[model samples]
Target: MTTATPAPTPAPAAAAETGVPAARRVPVARAYRFELVKLVAQWRIRLLVLACWIVPALFVIGVEQQSTLPSDTLFGRWMHATGWAGPLVVLGFAGTWALPLLTSVVAGDVFAAEDRLGTWRHLLVAVRSPRRIFAAKALAGLTVILLLVAGLACSGAAGGLVAVGGRPLVGLDGHVLAPGDAAGKVALAWVCVLAPTLALAAIGLLGSVTLGRSPTGLLLPALVALAMQLAQLLPLPVAVRLALPGYAFTAWNGLFTSPEQYGPLLIGVAVGLAWAVTATALAYLLFLRRDFTNPAHDGPGRRAVVLGVLPLAGLLAVTAAVLSPATGATGSGIEQAKVERSVATAFAHLYRMQTRQLNRPDVSEARLRATAACDKGSIRVPVRGPGNDWHCVVSWHLPGTDATGTAVYQLDITSDGRFVADGDGPKEVNGYFLVRTPTGDAPNPLWQFDGDVELLSHSKG
Candidate 1:
């Protein structure tokens, strides 16, 4: 009887070498290193980095030549004044969509391209574990985000310095910042942007891993970014606004002002990290549960429906729900006493600030003696909430003369202690211009506050 001895048990797979079947984890550091190497080798990534470095130079040149300043954007009003202004203007534009798009270019493609090129099985064979691969891919995407942001920041600062000259920057609070100090602030502002940029990149990676479609991966994150921006403009709750990534984008605005408010900046960082963690966790969980052995079994349509269409539809529904008009009539019944007192105080303080900027330290708020009486509409509706018909008659004395005039101001106040008032005040309310102290002459666009104005106090006088 030829009894064949049982073939020696095949050596346990490398994964089982640890004695535990599932605990066999690959070295994440090695995986991450390889991912970076792979990304760095891509021609497209090189081109993207190159673009991030070069485009700002072109933009600075182009904007410098333009006659009309883009006043609608913050810092844009001052773009023609100093080298620092160009960077601020670029930052504002980037916040709208450019930054998200640029960062997403690589992040969105990182994982989806594996699916697109039928490389998942190959990657799994080479890398061994899905979780490790996912972690590596995410790390690589984040690295790409850092590179893109850093490149833009350095290039933007260089472009601004080269094209506009390193002149002192005028702070939003009407203070003058020395060139060196302003440059540091500008660099810091760009660094702050990294938070939102990384958040957007994480979102792109999530879409890439879950949807596995190149277009969806690219479009989804961009859409989310744009939607966040739009939501900020909507009549959303303050809590919701505070949690949004778009709100974080504007956090840099405080850096350019005196007494730099780091509260918003910190909040922005928290919101961004929250977004990144949430997105990365969800993507990783989904990737772990997914089967990558058979491309034939892959359900792109189902994935699109589950991950892409449904989320987009839900976003639209939420937007509609939030924007739906209420049956009850709404009105901003602001208080007259409060409006008069607030406007008068603001006018005095702002006028003094303007005078100080003009080198006229003699022009004091006490000397101005500003006062106002406000009225609503043609018929006297109850002096309360906001209305377009609300008007104010402000009277103030211009120093060195008994010159006093009643400037008619049309006021529009929001529920949030903010107001926009247009007046036929001195010089058509064309912002204050710096002048030679004694003469107090010339109309230089030095410091101007021609648009919206917010209230100082919430309560009535």
Candidate 2:
């Protein structure tokens, strides 16, 4: 009876001060702070931050340093609009490799670390609820992701600004852009790109729940990223890319131009969110039903695989559609359509000749092929080709002043006479002028257009 005195009636774990209402449930703020501390203290997270900043910064310097400004090099064509600095580098490299891996490193391990530390019991005991604990981890991961995104973006911009001059950016679609416009659009692209990737952070959460540890969950988002990129390359229906979270990876490039193309951007985000929400929910549900008494993930199992595969399959088609070179978008007006059929034929012989004809210096043409009209005041040369023909308008200007005038020759020619308008717009074709200058010799690559400009790059035809 004396021993059953309940050990002197031990007091409850309550507020330090009795009147403080039992400390009002430990204020979720404390838990949040605790979570932040845990995340910041993570070596994996610090390394990831380093990767985001250092790697992309180096990439920016590497490409910008090597590439010639206004370079028509393939890499230049694709990335020059954003320049070769950190922003472009991050945009080019981060989306391809760094971000995905960084995301995986932390996200995949978010929960696994707890299991590894045997802290599941401790965390559960303190948080008291699985859902709240998951929320804290998810929030922590997102905070980390955003911070990384910001870091990468800042480093890229700084690198580009410092090394390469802030020049007008060329877009993926081969359009020149203003500096301010380019910056704003690039920022928007970054936002669009990140929106879908947030799901990746959520993916880590789901992985953590399933693996009961962080490291075990990494494979899901990595596969998702790789799969999404492949999907964009496949020639499929738009629904494919639209349904995948990784679709945003390529759509970021579209933001560097006018009439921003976010078809893929929106799709990627929707699919990613769908995956993030559903998978994370399932992860928690699994936790609720699972018995973690002996927490162990089979290193690399097929279980969390569906988490990566399902959304990837759905979005692949969407990405393919988003990236499929749109014939209409590039070369498909009624005029362009008509031109597409025969524009090549008209230029074919010259293209084959592979000759680099000197620039002609004649503007306003006063002569015509006998078919000249007086009242019409026109000279339109009928350049005929196999089944297709084009009328090269010949309005005259002084011969010597021609090359220096508003007349733009929209063509890319080799050292030989072979030339192609770099695809769908007007390229000035300097021929024997009505008032030709024999001394006309500067090889100017400049070209202009009336109405809309469409060029046929040497590769296209």
Candidate 3:
């Protein structure tokens, strides 16, 4: 037998002769490419991308034709004031519902679809490593989400610019921004939304892996976003709200203010990163430990659950430790000095606008010399903190007038440092809700103005 042994036809040669290709290991990059190809090939994903690019444009056109604006949304009242407002108003709506649902549609189904089609075993055999497969799929989902967001932003901006024309934007602080400056800030605001959206996608990935069902995965992130929205309506502490997943949606409000605030945006990014890392890690561990042989068993085993939960708890502790110092007492309480400064600044700019509308000489903010004294309830009560009972007496000097003009404003402040100031003034000045301008009847800036104090600033009033 030894003499006759035809040096056993080599395995490679035998397989080649049999017309069967050898099973070769796929590198991570190759696996990633495959995932992207699969995702792009799906009709639904193609439609989603197309819709993302087209829907916002239609929305802008629709808004342009409408008489009444969506005043309840931030930047909505300014839709006709500047082209940039159109995109911002759309952003406000997308952040609450569209973003989470859109992202979940892909991220939640990426992994679960393989399980649903009974292709997990085949995928595992080809990739040879669950870790690589998970990494590839997760990266693919994230890439798609980023693309969708970019499409929405660009389309919205383009539509607004074309339909309404570029114009000076009225900022949240009542200051006017040049067309170029407003364009840049609007783009940056859209960029800021990416963090929380990615975090939501990661959560969707976790749901997809744990539940092994596309429908559940699709709904989980949306449900979580809704829960966060509801929680925001509660009287939770400012720090807690800042840490929430939904807060990033409104954090862009600070960017439009004069002396732009970056604290909320920074905290939002950190919180999002923490959530993304935690969710991805849990999903990866669960995917790695899952028993593919048993098609009926979908849930993770006890040991896998322990391994996943421990890291989540540890990461949460670490996040809290890192955020505590940065937030400090700033979020714990709203300082009276900060509120006074914000109100005074807003009033000065708005008063200038009022003067212009009345066909008077334009009043410069510096020349206005506006000052505000605010108190919560009676003088005995401290003026600091958030409340509807706060009242402010604002005094300003017009350039040529010897007599100082004083306006009494009733304030309602929220825990997050935003406030609405309703002026109690004679009808001829600050009391009118609308003012007749050359263009049309517009909102009276001094009647009921909105402003936000900078919680992170160290400057004393």
Candidate 4:
């Protein structure tokens, strides 16, 4: 009996000899590797990866063959004609809910799955501390978010290039960008969304840690996303609106316009990071204090709720105060003279561009001089204030004809220097037309309309 105490396992003995504590013995690197391995083996994650690749690919193929362009979205009007437009369309749809849902599928499960499987005790025994596990799980979730974005963005860009070819990308400012520059801009725009996407990951992780159930974790984060989106459309004060995460979703769109803006993008990144840090901190602190032995007794602590609810309530209170009519209209002053002058100038320029695109003879920029008088709403309204109903009357001259006519334009101007003008011109605005190009004439009604109807915006100075 005394003769045989078989030697302890070599690995365990070696580990003990190192003098490191048991918890310190299992390297964080090992934890990370284990978490990553588990993540890739997940069926749901695999399915999501597949969908990311397939959906964008199919969308590209379908858009390429389609005759009509999806004109409602930012760059949809040019999707059929340019490769760069596909990413913009994809971004618009992704911002709605797709990105949040996709990231949540895995992030929501990372920690809650352990409790669901009754493996908390086992996991604790295997690790030094719950902190390592928490860190690993959070890292895994963020990794998934990045991978999904990268995969989807690359697939969309590839499908677009193959289907439509790398033609020049059109900007919201009515300017053209080289294919390389546009590609970079599109890529950066995709990257910009990642900040908010990561915040969604944090939300998922917070829910997972709190509820200890994957489905509950997933649903809560998705609901938060929906709430953010609805809040954006509320006529809240500019400060409140600008602070909403939903505004961050659209910040990247500035990259596609002339004189690309970084203000929105910076604010978006900051807000997104703030949300992520706050959620993650709550999750980490809760996990540190949670009881692992009796998992059933564990619950999202009151402190967790307080931490989460306080910030949200503060934001809501601010929003409520701003939404009160007592705050007056939530918009910057609409400079009537500035609006009239800018709109007239934009109309003249856009009309010239339209004619050039049509290759219509006898239309010169000089002859297209436009004089506009803008009235806010009805004549009794006195051309002041901003309530979406702004009208403009323009008198213009056309070349090769003694045609001097007035066109009535309806304008919708925002607090931002953005304006939309719809008018019936002397001729078809952009409808049925014969496109004459160096490649030869083709009967494509890409740019043809009646009464010269136009939509114009001036987003820059």
User: Best candidate, TM-score-wise?
Assistant: 3
Worst 10 residues of 2 by lDDT: 368-377
lDDT, candidate 2, residue 401?
Answer: 42
- Quick one: ranking by lDDT, best first? 3, 4, 1, 2
- Summarize candidate 4's per-residue lDDT along 1-461 as a digit string, tens digits: 46777765446567679764333446677888888888989888888888887788689768889887676556776777788888778887887878878867878778878877888888777876787888888887788777888778888887888899889876654456899999999988887788788777787888888777647676766787888877664544444555565556777766755556576566667767767777788778777878887868445667657765576556546644644443343443345665666555555655656566666664654577777787876667756434468777767788656877576667665433345565544335523344465567643322321111111122223
Name the 10 consecutive residues with the lowest summed lDDT in model 3: 1-10
- The CA lDDT at 408 in model 1 is 62
Candidate 3 ranges with C-alpha deviation above 4 Å: 1-22, 301-310, 376-389, 437-442, 458-461
Please identify model 2 stretches exceeding 4 Å from their true place: 1-25, 67-86, 213-216, 292-461
Tens digit per residue, CA lDDT, model 3, 215-281: 7666888988898788766665556667776677878889989888898878877787778888888
Which candidate gets the maximum lDDT versus the true structure? 3
TM-score of each: 0.74, 0.63, 0.88, 0.79
Compared to the true structure, candidate 3 yields what TM-score?
0.88
lDDT of 1 by residue, 80-159 (tens): 67889888777877777778787667788888778778888888877788889988988887887788777777777777
Q: How well does candidate 2 score on lDDT at residue 325? A: 55
- Give the lDDT of residue 104 in candidate 2: 84
How does model 2 fare in lDDT?
0.51
Model 3: pairs clashing at backbone N, Cα or C within 3 Å: none
